[model samples]
Target: GAGVSQSPSNKVTEKGKDVELRCDPISGHTALYWYRQSLGQGLEFLIYFQGNSAPDKSGLPSDRFSAERTGGSVSTLTIQRTQQEDSAVYLCASSNGQLTNEKLFFGSGTQLSVL
Candidate 1:
């Protein structure tokens, strides 16, 4: 893809079910990040992967939330045992540089609905 791509634009699941969201970054980009956005809320950083460096998982809310970037191209975010509060838009972004000043290209995101 020419830019960040996210799969399953929308997802609805039961409260106890799990969900996986996929992200594919643009070619040659090395930095990837996952974020969550609730209704009328700002984006909340979830995780970040940069080059061969260890992923920064400091933003994950709990152990149930996890993400992995494979081969520096694709990434997946998994939410285990979802709760109603977990319903939100999962966004993925990628950048060419690891520095905070770099510009990021974001995906359309997957809207998760837990009932």
Candidate 2:
């Protein structure tokens, strides 16, 4: 894909179910990130992966939320035991690096709805 690609544009699950969202970054990009935006709210950083360095998971709201990047290319975010409060649009973005002036290419995002 020429830009970031996220799978399952929308998902609806029960409160206790699990959901997984996938993202494929642009080719040769080394920085991947996950962010969530609730209705009418700003985006919240979830996790960040840069090259081989350890993933920064500090922004995850709880243990129920987790993410992993494989081969520095594709990444997946998993939300376990979903709650209504977890419903949001999960966005993925990629950049060449963390340079202050670099711009990120974002995916359309997966909108998750927990009932």
- List clashing residue pairs in candidate 1: none
TM-score per prediction, in order, is: 0.94, 0.94
List model 1 lDDT by residue over 1-115, tens digit each.
7889999999999999989999998888899988889999999998888963446899999999988877878898999999999999999989897685358889999999999
For candidate 1, what is the TM-score? 0.94
lDDT of 2 by residue, 49-103 (tens): 8963545889999999988888989888999999999999999999986763258
Root-mean-square deviation of Cα positions for candidate 1 versus the true structure, in angstroms: 1.3
Question: Which whole-number lDDT from 0 to 100 does residue 80 have in model 1?
Answer: 97
Question: Which ten contiguous residues of candidate 1 have the minimum total lDDT?
Answer: 47-56
Candidate 1 residue runs with Cα over 4 Å from true position: 52-54, 100-102
